[model samples]
Target: MIRAYAALEKGGELKPFEYDPKPLGSEDVEIDVEYCGICHSDLSMLHNDWGMTQYPFVPGHEVVGKIADVGSAVKKLQVGQRVGLGWYSRSCMTCEWCMSGNHNLCATAEGTIVGRYGGFADKVRAHEAWVAPLPDAMQPVSAGPLFCGGITVFNPIVQFDVKPTDRVGVIGIGGLGHMALRFLHAWGCDVSAFSSSADKEPEAREMGANHFINSRDPNALKSVEGSFDLILSTVNADLDWSTYIACLRPKGRLHFVGVVPNPISTEIFPLIMAQRSISGSPLGSPATVTQMLDFATRHQIEPIIETFSFDQVNEALEHLRSGKARYRIVLKH
Candidate 1:
């Protein structure tokens, strides 16, 4: 039996719950969760904001744990091996995207919490392919968010083929943006940070941003026109996107990793004239995550995080809801 905190209904408080899972499949592994990160996606799912959440939901996707059990066919991961799991727990191994090493793009990929119990528990299970082993140099307690937020931001750099010499801009100096600033800087790009908050300028710079643009100021936005090779928007809030579109150089791209609830509205002319493009991506494939983890280990880059005991999960959730988390929150068991 697995013991976990679960919401009995939509918008309900999480309470103690337990269940016996079916026998593990041949390719499955059970993880003894050591730490789990609280993501905005967890909050969204808690309230059924996406309208796809199931009741008795255990909402955690950013997981770091040691393998407690593995099925007969598991090979790469063994019991007692440390690992991390992200938003996705499984994908059909036979799909074209999976075959091409783009399993995150698999149409039938299974979300960690979509219709299943997740990692807010004593133990959780996932297919072997989605479980990424943590490099020995990485700290397990703070590595959970890297599986999700870290990968979400890092995948774009790889997928878009962002170059070391390119000028890159990151919007919103929060969870994903902070990591973007660090990664882009380490990648040797001239990195800029765009934030509505003036207070974030110093922190953004500290995180490796070479320039800071006050996103709230029109003139500040105008000054950098046609300057960036790529601008990664990591904020969910809607802003003057048309202006952002204009900030792009010819053939530049404006990519989104944030989950903005409303429809994006921007003039098509700017994009048409400049050959600029707007795109968005979910978390990276497992292979991409491995690369990201390796890079982070090599660069000694880690998310700015605050920790809480698993017993205080509700308080941790409230901290994240209040927007007071230093950047990311981790729950230690």
Candidate 2:
């Protein structure tokens, strides 16, 4: 039986729960979770925000753990090896997308918390393909966010072939944005951070932003028109996206890693006239996750995280909901 904390109803408090897992598959592995990160998506699932959450939900995908058990056919991972799991727990290995090495795009991909118990537990299980081994130099405590937030931002850089000398802009210096600034800066881009909060400027620069633009100021927004080669938005809130589109240079791209609640309303003429593009991506494939971990370790980039004991899960969720978490929250087992 696996012991976990689960919400028995929509928006209910998580309580102690236990259940015997199904017989482990020949291609699966069981992880002894050491720490897990709380993501906004977890909160969204807790309240059935996307309307796909199930009752007795356990909300955690950013998992850092060690292999406690492995299926007979699992060849790449060994028992006691450190690993991490992200938003996806499994994907149909025979799908065209998976065959093309884009498993994250597989139509049959399984979310860690969509209909299954997740890392808010003593143990979690996933197929070997979705489990990524951790880099030796990477610290496991703060490495949880990299599996989700870090990969969300990093995938675009690789997919788009962001040039090292190109100018890049990051909107919202929070969880995803902060990691973007660090990665882009280390990647040798001229990094700009856009935020409504003026106070975040200092920290943003310290994290590798070459410039800080007050997103709330019209003039500041205007001054950077036609400036960026790429703009990565990491905030979930909807904004005057046209304004951001106007800031892009010809052939530049505006990408999204955040989940904006409303459908985007924008003019098509600007994109046509400037040859610009607007796009978004989900979390990366396992291969890309490996690359991201290696890059993070080499650059010494890690999320700014606040730690909590597993029993303080409720308080940590509330802190995240209250918007007081410095950047990311990690619950230790």
Candidate 3:
């Protein structure tokens, strides 16, 4: 039996719950969750914002833990290895995308909290392919967010071949954006941070931003036009995206890792005239995640996180709801 805190209904309070897990398959492994990160996506699912959440939901996907059990077919991971699991719990290994090493793009990928219990409990289970071993130098407590938020931003840098000499701009200096600033800085790019909050400038610079742009100021946005090689937007709120597009150099790209509620509105002429591009990506493949962890370890880059005990899950949720989390929230088991 797996013991966990679960919401009984849509937007309901979480209560203690237990259920018998199915027989562990030959390819599955059970993780003794040490720490889990609370993501905004968890809150959205808790309230059924995307309309696919199931009741008795246990919301956690940014998991850092040790393997407590491993199926016979799992050869790479052992019973005591430290590992992390992200948004995906499983993907059909036979798919063309999976075969080509783009497992995150698999059509039938399984979300950790979509229809299954997640890492909010003492234990969670996932296929070996979705489990990534943690590097020895990486601290497990602060490593949870890297599996989701970290990889979300890092994947684009790798996929788009962002050069070290490129000028990069990050929008929204929050959970996802802050991490982007750190990684891009370590990658040797000239990093810029764009935020509506003027107060974030100092922290953004400390996080590795070379310049800070007040996103709310029209003149500030205009001054950087035709400057950036890439702009990574990590905010969920919709904005006048055309202005951001205008900031890009010819052949530059505006990428998104954030989930904007509305369809994006932008001018096509800028893209056509300048050869600029607009794109977005989900959490990265396991291989890319491993690479990100190694890079983070080398650069000493970790998420700015606030810790909470699993028992304080509700309070932590409310704190995140109130928008007071310094950057990311982690739950200790």
Candidate 2: residue pairs that collide: none
Candidate 3 C-alpha lDDT tens digits along 77-122: 9999999999999999998999999999999999999999998999
For candidate 2, the per-residue lDDT at 301 reads 97
TM-score of decoy 1: 0.99
Error of 2 at 77 (Å): 0.4
Please, what are the lDDT tens digits per residue for candidate 1 over residues 233-262?
998887888898899999999999998879
Off by more than 4 A, model 1? none
In order, candidate lDDTs are 0.95, 0.96, 0.95
Query: How many clashes does each candidate structure show, in the order listed?
Result: 0, 0, 0
Poorest lDDT segment (10 consecutive residues) of candidate 2: 10-19
Q: Against the true structure, what is each candidate's TM-score? A: 0.99, 0.99, 0.99
Residue 70 lDDT in model 2?
A: 98
In model 2, the Cα lDDT at residue 88 comes to: 99
> If both were scored by lDDT, which would come out higher, candidate 1 or candidate 3?
3
* lDDT by residue for model 2 (1-333), tens: 999999999999999999899999999999999999999999999999999999889889999999999999999999999999999999998989999999999999999998899999999999999999998899999999998999999999999999999999999998899999999999999999999999999999999999999999999999999999999999999999999999999999999999999999999999999999999999999999999999999999999999999999999999999999889999998
